[model samples]
Target: MKFLFDIFPVILFFLTFKLYDIFIATAVAIVAAIAQIGWLWLRKQQIEKMMWINLAIIVVLGGATLLAQDETFIKWKPTVLYWLIASVLLVSSLVFRKNLIKLMLEKQIVLPVAVWDKLNLSWTVFFLLMGAVNLYVAFSFSVDIWVTFKLFGATGMMLVFIILQVMVLGKHLKPMPERIQTVNEQDNLIEKIDNKAGKK
Candidate 1:
């Protein structure tokens, strides 16, 4: 559900492009991006940093496409966004000495420090490659093909990458220890049992 929501604008853009043209699709994408943020704000949802980044990029590049009457701006949108994300991940880990991925997932899962670093680097590299791929498709293929690739090919690749990441991470995931009662907790439990028996 969340994944669909994240790609809402892309889906709308692809459909609009098929029904109309690139210009119309760009306008729809811009509107969709704005609407997405507005809806989240109205619902009092915590808007993620990445959502804001995406919205900003779409508005800027999409607006350029509309105002200048050129599809080039819109075509560059995905590449720019992907590179920005990759840069953030790389800079945060290397210069800031902080792993954003680890920070986000550490509460839910535990892994060795080395594993965390590798995971972060892997994502950084993947985004870089995705950005390059977007450029290749956008310039080498027709607009129709690029739009289709944007909607399906890019999404499919992302899913495949994530599945592979999960498979690799599974080997390193630490098994959760079984819960054990402390001595004090055991004493409390026994006292409660005795009290219940006395009442009976």
Candidate 2:
């Protein structure tokens, strides 16, 4: 439910962005994020700290875009968002018993504490790397290429990362899904046939 609630604003942002400029899109996302916070409060859910961070970045970046009427401000927002999140992740690792990312995902994954720490470190490093890549693309590359890279290249890299992680953790992961595993009755059937022949 929380996950579904989270995507609602992203969907809204896509729609608004399609119909308007970068400034309007940024503003819409900010407004939607605020609404999401309100919804969380009303439902008695703990507001995510990352959501607050995201909100602050959106508000500041969106304000700048509006004030300057420059799409560059909005364009650079992704770089800012990535780096800021990465910094927070690293800081959390240093200050807390568990990194915040690990805490957020702990309920879904029943990994050992050491595994959690490893996961936290991996995510921290990945975010930092991604942040640097985003900064490079946004500031140094052509605007069209930067936008395209952000939309497509980043997603592709993330998918690859997930595949790599799964492969690396195959031994530690749960066995094949029950539905996909065939029952091993052949050996039993053969044993029963041989016993009947011997009795005869």
Candidate 3:
């Protein structure tokens, strides 16, 4: 699945850390990220901007972590990526007068402008909060705990957030015309019954 491909680097990083150490895991992550991007290129697939950003961060931060033999740089990678995404959402919404979330999802969903704006803002805030949370866990915990947080905490939070977003979107979804007409007719009949009861 595409989801598995996107997260292949992180998965490798976690497994490597479990087997060896942070430096080796960081090195593995760097290689995996580059390989992922190269594979996409060879397939002639259009890489998403987020994927490019991820590769850049992995190479730069992960490389620094390996070269300096410091786990700090690699630890910051997720926070950096999260903040970058937050910035993109904020800038696109405020500066460009566009909702990046809506732009990404418009083909798959249809909702009112207000609903789109709400979705965009919600995601922006979520990313920002996640960035801060990553830092807190990375610093406040042991390397092993931090690594677990990196893989499970971050992924779990995003999955939960997405499920919640889907629930919200369901509430704002535009009903089909037939469903709308049926609802309207039911409302009219109910109103008629209420009037007849009141008169009697």
Best by lDDT: 1
Best by TM-score: 1
Question: Model 2: C-alpha RMSD to truth?
Answer: 6.3
Candidate 2, residues 64-142: lDDT per residue as tens digits? 8888987677666766777777777778788765477566765555565677677777877787788778778877876
Write the number of the candidate with greater TM-score, choosing between 2 and 3. 3
User: Which is the better candidate, 1 or 2, if ranked by lDDT?
Assistant: 1
Q: What's the TM-score of each model vs. the native? A: 0.89, 0.67, 0.86
C-alpha RMSD for every candidate:
3.8, 6.3, 7.3
- Predicted structure 1: clash tally: 0
Candidate 2 stretches with Cα past 4 Å from truth are 1-4, 95-97, 106-114, 140-156, 173-200
- For model 3, the superposed segments whose C-alpha errors exceed 4 Å read 175-200
Q: What would the per-residue lDDT of candidate 1 be over residues 107-186, giving only the tens digit for each residue? A: 77789999999999999999999999999999999999999999999999999999999999998987443323465678
For model 2 the local lDDT of residue 172 reads: 58
User: lDDT of all the models against the reference?
Assistant: 0.93, 0.72, 0.90
TM-score: the better of candidates 1 and 3 = 1
Pull out the clashing pairs in model 2. none
Distance from true location, Cα of 131 in model 2, Å: 1.5
Model 3 agreement with the true structure over 1-200: per-residue lDDT tens digits = 99889889989989999999999888888889889989989999998988889989988988888788888998899989989998999999999999988888886677999999988889889999999999999999999999998889999999999999888788788766777799999999999999999999
